[model samples]
Target: SSAVTKNTKIVLNLESLGSLPADEAGPLARYASTIQAQRHDYNGKVLSIRAEDLKSLAIIYDMSPDELTTRLIEWGVLSPGADVASYFDDE
Candidate 1:
């Protein structure tokens, strides 16, 4: 099935993951700290969300797959790369 390979991987920005703003992001949100800066300006974290699951999440949020993908990148949940974003998009 096409599901076996598409939208398989996405990198997350560790710094932004836990700091998603509450007012903007709702339940999974918290205040981000700016005082404790990363030693090497690091935000690297890799998390591969299963394609089906991501698709399901997008559906629940009433957002198109592309929109959700873009939002994830914006929120630092996904790496910022147009190529990466579209690589796994549903056909």
Candidate 2:
């Protein structure tokens, strides 16, 4: 028998969620809500998360706007070509 070794682990930094003000409600908040929603609807599918969702996701993931966007895309949270930083910059 052969032993298997772990390949990779992505660390989620809860601290990243701290940047957004608790009271600040918007796209970011939506993102957080969306994440929870998707988790409940897990079916190995990609869903459209708005810019707000992106922001919220970033906070939830403890990542910068750019970082969160990239990860979210990788995780099937958003479609490609969607710029998370641009969304925040628009606000």
Candidate 3:
């Protein structure tokens, strides 16, 4: 559940969300919503994934956390040297 909540917060904080074209924001928001719903289903249970697992999940989505951070930087979503994990430290 924390994973879900943490991920939701991270998504919400993405500066790119505001600047992204509707076509992009729509899907990203939908994905965040899905994660939110899944979190709700957990009823406060903790997710038991490690950072590496999170990285693997990111890969399934076509990026690693580092890659995502880089993309966010490229999109002006995050400061150039931001620590990506800080956005989801709960995980």
Candidate 4:
């Protein structure tokens, strides 16, 4: 969906996949990096996110979909009515 896709793009554009130099970027960072790479391959097309994929993302980030959605909105990665889960479907 656009939320996942857009957010992924933002995360990917980060210098270090939104990670710090303490040691590792962690699971969320890793997932975001992967998503970003995919987006780059598609020229920034929104990635299709299944429920399972969303679950994995949540697990990695330790957040719920709603929470993630809210965070994405806060970060300006997702706009209202974006319907992240349905964005790729439209494509």
Task: Estimate every model's Cα lDDT from 0 to 1.
Answer: 0.53, 0.48, 0.50, 0.49
TM-score of each: 0.54, 0.40, 0.40, 0.44
lDDT of 1: 0.53
- Please write out the lDDT profile of model 4 over residues 40-65, one tens digit for every residue: 74444233444456556666667876
**Which residue pairs clash in candidate 3?**
none
Question: What alpha-carbon RMSD in Å does predicted model 4 have with respect to the real structure?
Answer: 7.6
Instruction: Name model 1 segments beyond 4 Å from true.
Output: 1-8, 23-45, 82-90
Candidate 3, run of 10 with poorest lDDT: 41-50
lDDT of 3 by residue, 39-69 (tens): 6733322222244544654665577676765
Best by TM-score: 1
Worst 10 residues of 1 by lDDT: 27-36
- Name the runs in model 4 displaced over 4 angstroms: 1-29, 36-42, 45-48, 84-91
Positional deviation of 64 in candidate 4, in angstroms?
Answer: 1.7
Error of model 4, residue 46, in angstroms: 4.5
lDDT by residue for model 2 over 1-91, one digit each (tens)? 1112121122222234334455542444455446657678433233433455445556766778778667545644444544445555535
Candidate 3: residue 26 lDDT (0-100): 60
